[model samples]
Target: MTASHAPFIAACTELLGASHVLTHDHDTEPFLVDWRKRYRGNACAVLLPADTAEVAAVVGLAHEHGVAIVPQGGNTGLAGGATPDESGAQAVLSLRRLNRIRGIDPHNNTITVEAGVVLAEVQSRAESAQRLFALSLAAEGSCTIGGNLSTNAGGTGVLRYGNTRELCLGLEVVTPQGDIWDGLRGLRKDNTGYDLRDLYIGAEGTLGIITAAVMKLHPAPVARVTALAGLASPHAALDFLAMAQRHAGALLTGFELMSDFSMRLVGRHFPQLRYPFGEPHAQTVLLELSDSESDEHARALFERLMEQAMEEGIVEDAVVAESLAQSQAFWDLREHIPLAQAEEGLNIKHDIAVPISSIGRFIEETDAIIARATPGARMVTFGHLGDGNLHYNVQAPEGVDQKQFLEAFQTPINALVYDQVHAHRGSISAEHGLGQLKVDEAMHYKSAVEVRLMQSIKAALDPENRMNPGKVVRWAQAGTRKENIA
Candidate 1:
């Protein structure tokens, strides 16, 4: 340990016990890096705070010492949001120990949970209550509620429900100044004064530490029907989505887009799972219909839509999941694309979004752009088609060095894709919040006034920029003092 951080580490050890404070390189290495392995950082220590009070104490101590904090949960983020910087002065605050579901009120349909609560556990608890916690993602097994809320995550359910911001009613946040804001109101209507709950939700921990949250819940779906349909192109896929929306409407809970290349990669990597389609198709849609009525109703709605789609030539081939196992298998194919891509090689990933109408053009143009620019680069494109978010990723060619391709083309490809995204009035980041990966890009695409407003918010909340520095909005311009405060 460095001589300067000795007392700070000792104070943390004193507060949360010596065992809870990790200073050793081996003990803290995992927490220092992001899930993508794209960013590896260094920290003076990792402090595990067991509860809200403990977290408050940790924040207070860090504030007193003027030390920055990088609040991390599960370490499953892709944008390097949780990882600390190369500077070894910051402290990685681990929130994994505060995994508690405080309450579940069936009448009000709300679930109060600690920040460190795993997303899958919350879903299970909701199911036990005969309700549903709608915020679900691929990382639900390990991703924590705090991280999800911090990122304002949008998963497949976003089509029917909403993002984490809409899922959450209130939050228990510890401000950068170490003061607790117990605004955990379960009320659906609160029009009094400024909405402080929102300020912390998608701030990516740059404003404050979200210790717990009151999340909105919904009545459990009595039935769900899953289907994988083949399409000739993204244009056809858009038409398919439009037709599904017209037929099923709100019951059409999910509509995911998967390129043929993405499905091919999955098939090549994982042979055990049943592939979605046998023949070649340019694009496919993983659509689902859910209802609070009976299974027959959901199946009837899905079948009617599929029949109409086939007649209209929107769907070339389709498979309806007759059983729960079949439905899960269909989802399994969609969920494992990232795993398959990882198994293939280093991938330069882009979490992007465009209007549903423009998605076809977006894909066609970007696909051509990537192919023409980078020869033989494998494009794995898939994501929440209903809500317009796509995980458009790229892999090096058959024999190109993965690292070399990423190093050479990462910048230009990002610019090309993001430029097209902005040109189409789309977002560079839709579901995944702008972490370290796209902060600079955010400043670029975002208007000067908008960026200034955001910077003012961050500076107002955290004057010293001690809270999750360099992830969302970093300190711009000289002097640490807050000038022209909002």
Candidate 2:
């Protein structure tokens, strides 16, 4: 470490015990890298604070020293938002030590928790109280509440419970200047002024650190039924979606679309999970219904929907889970796509969203263009069809070197896909925030006015730009502006 940075390090070691201040490379390596291992940053030190007060103190110390602080929770972020830059000058403030479920108000239907609490733990706690906290995701076992809010994570439950932003009611954030803003109100409606809570959530720590949150909970569903439908094409899947929605309404909780190629990838990697269909179809959909009444009610609804779908020839074949174990098995097929993709090789990944009505056309046109440009390219397309979000990923051509394929086609392929998304009036990013990966691309697609407004907000809240620099919105002059965040 440099002599100039010694004082800052010593101060942090003093504020948080030396045991909590990790400076050695071996001790700090895990916090420096992201879950995907795509981003590896450097930090002068990794600080772990035990509570909100300790966090505030650590942030204050960093602010006084003019050291950049990257707030991280669980280090499970896919977009590299929680990782520091390569400068080795920033300090990583890890929030994993702050885990605590403060209280569960069963009557109010709200649960207050520290940001470090894992997503699955929240669900379990809510369930224990005869309530449901429904921000479900693949990383729920490890990802923290703070990370979910920062990325505004969306999972299968988004169709009914909405995204993390919709499920959250309040947040306690530590701002760039080391001041705590306790806006943690559990009220369903609070329209007094500007929403400061929202400013921190989904900001990716660019503005401030989210320490805790008050999340909304719902009554536990009496029964949840899952089904897999084999369809001829994306058009047929869309028709099934419309029909299912008409029949189930809000009870339709999860709807996912998986391309035939995607299913094949799963089958190739995980041979044990048998494909539910007799023959391969062009597209397949996984449907879920959460009935508040009973299993019989859910079964009746599914029977009518499946009967009509088969009679109309919308679905070639379908299978509904008869038990909970079978339902989980159906979900396992959908969730294993990402893992299978990793097993195949390095590929281009896109978390995008288009109008629900326009998804089939978008996929058809974009897939054709990708195929023509890069002949033999395999498409692994699947995601939350109910909410119009697709994990539209591109795989290397069979028999080609995966690394070489990504090196040559990642940029051009991304451009092609994004252009089509823009044409369809869709978003380049659906759930994952634009970390360092998509920052420049987001700028290219966003209008000048929108960019300026975002920059203005960044400048206003974190004028110094010491809070997670080089993320979301980039400021030409960072760490200089001294405007009050208030």
Candidate 3:
């Protein structure tokens, strides 16, 4: 669109070949739009590099041209982290071409993979070697490992294995200045100064483009059991989780909380899925157990725990999967929440996290607050209860215009939910990074000092603000000068 953008596009094309450079409107359209379709941006072009060297070359070219570069991986991010701004001066660097699993060391319990490798592929590869890649998510089929690491993705397995940041042993990144930081080491313990790998893990691509990563892996569980438990209330669900954790210990892999609304949504949207319980309880907890021991032993242990929980009044009812097929079906119901919600209608979602102990109270109070503020709003809450993260969503009441409700109550509703999270010392963004969606709102809760420190780090790493600008860090010259301001 601009007379000056010709050279920038030309440079990118020269670095990544004409085939790899996507300048046509049709070719770059998908990269410009976000997953939620909430934001649409304009990028001059999209660059697809085949390897780390080519990525470094393309990033170097963009740096020299003084054009912004938005690093994208599968474009599966919930927040618009990969979407460029409206300026049309940026180029989206797609990592899809770099899909490769370089190495899997079973003895070392690590896997080195390219950023573009889909999460499901990584899991499968690990499984093939009798190992387990525990970082699991609903979007694993399409979400790229690079995007997962960039967002520091947390899913059900996070309760046992940890987030992407913890799973990542090292990363190979192309910095804003076009320099490649080859820090891809699989060391179990490295006390080298400054954990630079972490800086880009959840930076949302603002710092650099992750080309590849050395990820941790675990031994495949020989035995596994899945249980669906009915609870009296959110408090009861938490009590069940505490009791289960006390008995199951590290074997308790996943503890998810689902409300009655969530179950109805699933049953309505996914008719194929039969409700495990005959009657709708106040809440449900999908509990998972995994061990290297025998399957029978694992199932017996889970059954015993469930019986004990029922006797203690922690569990209203429970069902332990007798077979692997049954176990997967239970997980299918839990993992399909997003899909089910999508089919139902428009809703405002808050992926908030609170203290484990305060989650029950927070949910009760927040539900009451939401009902009072926005009457007729249907609350659908569920998520990794063990980790204190909840997909607290508010659906527009029946026969109401979704857009109008969103326009009127989005901010207020978010504040209401987030305030409770803040009060409980929880995170507004539990798994998703602060992309364009929450950049401004994050300021309201984060302290001036904390914001300044983040800004300073961004300025220090990406002074020109060419790498995924206008993300995690607020990029104003005045704001960058933290010391001068205060």
lDDT of each: 0.90, 0.91, 0.89
Worst 10 residues of 3 by lDDT: 477-486
- Under the 3 Å rule for N, CA and C atoms, how many clashes does model 1 have? 0
TM-score of each: 0.96, 0.97, 0.97
Clashing pairs in 2: 464-479
Q: List candidate 3 segments past 4 Å from native.
A: 480-486
Flag clash pairs in model 3: none
Q: Which pairs of residues collide in model 1? A: none
In model 3, state the lDDT of residue 11.
78
Q: Model 1 reaches what TM-score against the true structure?
A: 0.96
Tens-digit lDDT track of model 2 for 1-486: 456778888998888899999999999999999889999999999999999998888888888889999989888878888898898999999999889999999999999999999999999999999999989999999999999999899998999999999999999999888899998899988989998887777889999999999999999999999999999999999999999999999999999999999999999999988888879999999999999999999999999999999999999999999888899989999999999999999999999999999999999999999999899999999999989999999999999999999999999999999999999999999999888778777777877667777888888888888899988876754322221110
**Per-residue lDDT for 99-171 in model 3, tens only?**
9999999999999999999999999999999999999988899999999999999998988988899999999
Q: If the candidates were sorted by their lDDT against the true structure, best first, what order would they fall in?
A: 2, 1, 3
Off by over 4 Å in 1: 477-486
Clashes of 2: 1
The CA lDDT at 400 in model 1 is: 93
Q: Model 1: per-residue lDDT, tens digit, 73-150?
A: 989987999999998999999999999999999999999999999999999999999999988889999999999999
Scored by lDDT, model 3 comes in at 0.89
